[model samples]
Target: MPDAQTPQLAFHNVSFAFDETPVLRNVSFELSSGETLIVLGAAGSGKTVLLKTALGLLRPTQGRVVLFGADVTAGSEREWFDIRSRIGVLFQEGGLFDSLDVADNVAYPLRNQPLRQCPEEQVLPKVEESLKFVDLGHTLDKYPSELSGGMRRRVGIARAIVTQPELMLYDSPTAGLDPITANIIVALITKGRDVRNATTVMVTHRFQDGEILAGFRYDTAAGGLGLTPDHRGDTQTRFLVLREGEMVFLGTQAELEASQDSYVSKFVPHT
Candidate 1:
């Protein structure tokens, strides 16, 4: 079991290389439970690589990755299966099975459990509950082809949260969508963080998305999400900016904006 003060996820001097080309160099960070970490970077700056490393899909060439206080850097696939169950990943393209309907897509993880068998009767309710959480209960019977890009992303969110994962990883959940749809996706992410209280690490190229997520809070009493005026300091949400395989900035939104680094300052103002 993880200690009370153990970070949900931690990277210790992690580095990776594709042959001679280094992808991540000396990356280090810790994500505590109930906190959201937003990673921002330009293309090829190792944003997605960070998520893959956390998921154990790509091993670090150097250093270690700790999840729930347990070293997972060299863990076997069998070990990884247990670790992965407690984490959820939402890919950029909403990687739902084209043949499966919304419900089935959401139910895939539960039904495929290797350690414990889950009956359809038990799984069906979870599917419904997950879809409902994303406001997609009515899309249960609809196939992926029948859903719009935004709807597909919503279903992806439903699928990701169905297991009520302790940690959620999002890779550009709002990419390639209109402002309205992107805001909707952002709201769902907020709901996951606020309502479900899941730890999150999200990668995005858009600074506005990061700003909004860090600035907003789900107001249960008000029945809507509201922004923290002036996007003031939010300790719950932190930013990590990478530039060419190195961490350039790591701080709260206010600190990020206050950064004087040439790369960070240039990137923040335009984004």
Candidate 2:
């Protein structure tokens, strides 16, 4: 298991709010390089906010967000852009531009950028290669309106990783899909992380992907929360539960399974 202190991404006492209405309350966590940590919580749990902060797109109202050994909360615009270039983010909706073709969408991040350092002829090939990586090679010329939801999501993923980002942030990657499609998306997400050895953070509600983190969450008698076993023999995963702008629990999946706290108990699905 990765050590807790080996943080590629760290949030220390981070807090955020909109118009003085707090959304996240002193939340903190760390993920080592090449580790995939899935963030879980009920609706409106600030998962997206956390993801954005890590991406350097949003500033935390309190504390620090450290990336690549630099406090992103302190970087200038150019420095921030440079740090952002090293990471890929696959949004829940896939975030592909409707006006551009699939290949162009993949190339969007590289366009006119001083960082790419590649000539014009090379860009199309790189775009083609990214599409191939996402298994959408044949759809390079297609438009977003012409693709299925799954296909569009794949394209968005292609664009995210096209820059070869060192970290990846995915929001609800498997939402709005069938069982088989969801599994495929999960496989793609995991495969990219493993291949790149990138620090991965997934904002998802599903327990299937949550099994990868190395901890648990607190349970309440209401059964909304529970623990996952430490010795389940699968990868260890941590679970964090947030409610009403407060962090209620942060533990391994094993620990969450054993808790009986009312707030956590209500979430255990009833058969």
Candidate 3:
């Protein structure tokens, strides 16, 4: 078990580029166990790239990426595969395979990841429980094409959480969903954080996603989100804003809202 001092995830001066062009520049942040980081930015602002780099899906051009106190900046693919087994990721648009049914999709990580030795017999039951957590227990037999967009997103969440990873990364989880569906998804994300005490990094375009994360805690007894008392000021959640591949803001909701930077202010969502 990792000691309490180690951060669940950290990016140290990380930068990434695509050929001659840069997509992320000198971006750095750290998320401790059970802490939440909300990433916000306009289109093409490197939000997705940041998550991908942290997950080792993309190699950085400079600096180090650390997971569970280990440096993985230049880790080999085989090493990354083992490290990835301990982290869960929900890629943009659910990223589910249309060829696989819900159960199989959720079971993919368990069966494929080198560190997860989940026995074949235990896969289905674990998959079912994960789906149930996302309120889609009955959709096990369903295919990705059969479900609505929102339901598919939930399935993605189910798949991401099935391995009970210590770190979870969500990229544009509610990008195309309606407000109601989006709120439900964020609520489920909050529930996952509270129930599992997992470290979370969510990249989203919606400021409301960050608000809900900072203002509420999942109430297991009530089976839903409950307003966190004293949430207006102090909170465990923090927000980071990116501008043209650079981190322009990193602070709490209050600090982020108060930021006067023209680029940062654009994400505050004028109510």
Candidate 4:
């Protein structure tokens, strides 16, 4: 078993800047094997930049991005792909291939691999199973152009998890969708946490988005994202409120709500 002390995913004093423009400053956090890490930041607050850093698409100017204690800051692309395979990321947009139908799009990742885990016969069943999880079984023959935004997002999710990754990263999964559909997506995400024992990371700004995450929390192990016994409420979840690329507050959800800071208060819900 992995050490209880070693975090599954970790960022330590991570600082990154583009030329003179600073994005993330001394950001640090740890996510366990089965915990859900929700990141709340306003528009242009470097949330996306942080995801890129985690994915190795962006390198940190200082500190480290660690996965299972292995530093990713200096790895080659080929070296990174090994780590990337263990992670599944849901992009802001569905990021589907318009040319391919849903099934093909979901199966695309397996096609590029140099070796097959199972026989060729296993591919179709896995594809079907993945789509089934997202409730997209009927849309298999349809192209991304033919699907609704919600369906596209679900399809993207199906594609991401088709590989059975250890970690799941969501980038604005509910953006540009109606409230009803967004809620459905939230439920689907929660269901995913229940079905697969995968660590989760989500980035969004809506209070409802925060609420959906709050909903993901519960006293019992069932409600939370498969968190271990050591962490009931002890699991740490903090928010970093950023403005013009600088952090103004770093604390809990309640702390963020009660904050007297003008930037934070303005962003809080009217109620």
Candidate 5:
């Protein structure tokens, strides 16, 4: 087992390409346990590729990916099974099974590879608890098609978190939703982070998403997000901006806001 000091995820001078076309170039970053990284970029900025590479879905053409303190850039698919089981991912658009009900979807990890040994008796309760965690406890029987877009996204979140993963990767969780719904999704994400103390990496194009992750925390007593500017150090949120497959900036929200670079400043919302 890796020592506690190891970064939960690290990409060292990583680059990825497809058929001679480069998508990411010499990208690198580290996310410690309980810290949150918000990746911002315009469409096709390699944000999704970066997230997938971190998850070992795509091998790097050059460089290394360290997970839990072990190098896994060349790790085989079978070898990645255990590593992946320890992480949770919420893909774009709530990637739920249209054929399955919410309960079945959330219970999938427990009954599948790497976690397949989980007792049958524990599956339902685990599913229920995960759903409740996302405020979707009553949607167990609902299909993805039956739920609203926002609710489906909640189910996606519940599924991502059902494993109580040590790492959570969210790919554009708020993409395609109304502003109100988007905020709600982000609040749930905040609640999950504060409640589980899970390390998180979220990829989004919206600057507000990064702002919320940096400036707010889940208030357990109030059951919602609360301003925690005084606890900024404790929050540990950072922003990473990507442009055309390259990392253009990596810093705190304040630093991001203060950036003078034209490209980086474009992602910073103007008051």
Candidate 6:
């Protein structure tokens, strides 16, 4: 368990509704530094609303969202601007601008800062570094329209990590992609956790993705990324199962597999 100090993200008895429609009901969880929390649920399961609440984009009707130990549920938009800088979000879609090239899109966040704070020279190098990290360095000049869906998603990831945020939120990153391409995106996300040590909360219905992320470790010895056979007990990855706007199960991969809950068993993929 994480110490009693400060959690990177927390939701306490959070509930949200749209008019008479309840979306999230009494959802609560905490993400510590360098941990990855995989949220598994079907469509319309309130996953995206949870992400929005974490980012302070949406306020909960019942409970508050605490970010880095600070309750930002009641914060104004102006106050959220600074808080947002410390977090990164990858939308379900690529969310790239059609008019901008890859490099510019990656640099968009940095450019929003004061010119005196981020000079032109500093901006380009950072953009180049971020793109290189995602293996998209060669696509710097390519427009979103000119790239494939997988490539566009990679570009979106490059843009998200450009500022080196301490927290990352991904909404169905692997949805609607071929298995091979989805694996590539999963690899990139793992890199963020293993290399950058960024705390992450990902929403996905793919059981394979959750398993790969929780079971695999980056093998630096191969000079490339690959899965490790032995499951390290020290893994920081965890699974959170959401059903009907409520948490049904939260545990390690082994615990999840051992669970007798029919709903959880049905969702667990067969090896």
TM-score of each: 0.94, 0.84, 0.97, 0.85, 0.97, 0.93
Give lDDT tens digits, candidate 6, residues 1-271: 3354579999999999989899899999888888889998888888888888888878899997888778888999877888888888888888899999998999988887432257778989999999988888898888999998888888889888888888999988999999999999988887877777789888998978877778776665664566555663554888888888888889888888888998877778767
Write down the RMSD of all candidates, one decimal each.
1.8, 7.3, 1.2, 3.9, 1.2, 2.5
**Candidate 2 lDDT:** 0.74
TM-score of candidate 1 on Cα atoms, chains taken together? 0.94
- Output candidate 5 Cα RMSD: 1.2
Worst 10 residues of 4 by lDDT: 226-235
lDDT of each: 0.88, 0.74, 0.92, 0.76, 0.91, 0.84
Task: Give the alpha carbon lDDT tens digit for every residue of 1-271 in model 3.
Answer: 6689788899999988999899999998888888999999999999999999998989999989999999999999999999999898898899999999999999999899999999999999999999999999999888999999999999999999999999999999999999999999999999988899889999998999999999999989988888888874434899999988999999999999898999889888776
Ranking by TM-score: 3, 5, 1, 6, 4, 2
Model 4 lDDT per residue over 1-271, tens place: 4586677789888888999788988888788787777776778888888888899988989989998678888899887877887788888997899999998898877665433344567778989999987788889899999999999999999988888877888888999999998977776776665466677787777656655554454323454344335432443445556565555676666677789988777767875
Please give the lDDT score at residue 229 for candidate 1.
63
Q: What's the true lDDT of residue 163 in model 4?
A: 86
**Of models 2 and 5, which has the larger TM-score?**
5
Better of 4 and 5 by TM-score: 5
- Please give, for residues 139-193, the per-residue lDDT of candidate 5 as tens digits: 9998899999999889999999888899999999999999999999999888889
lDDT order of candidates, top first = 3, 5, 1, 6, 4, 2
- Which ten residues in a row are the worst by lDDT in model 3? 226-235
- True lDDT of residue 141, candidate 4: 90
Q: Where does candidate 4 stray beyond 4 Å?
A: 113-118, 217-240, 247-251
Name the lDDT value of residue 269 in candidate 3. 76
Give candidate 2 misplaced runs (Cα > 4 Å). Answer: 1-6, 112-114, 212-237, 262-271
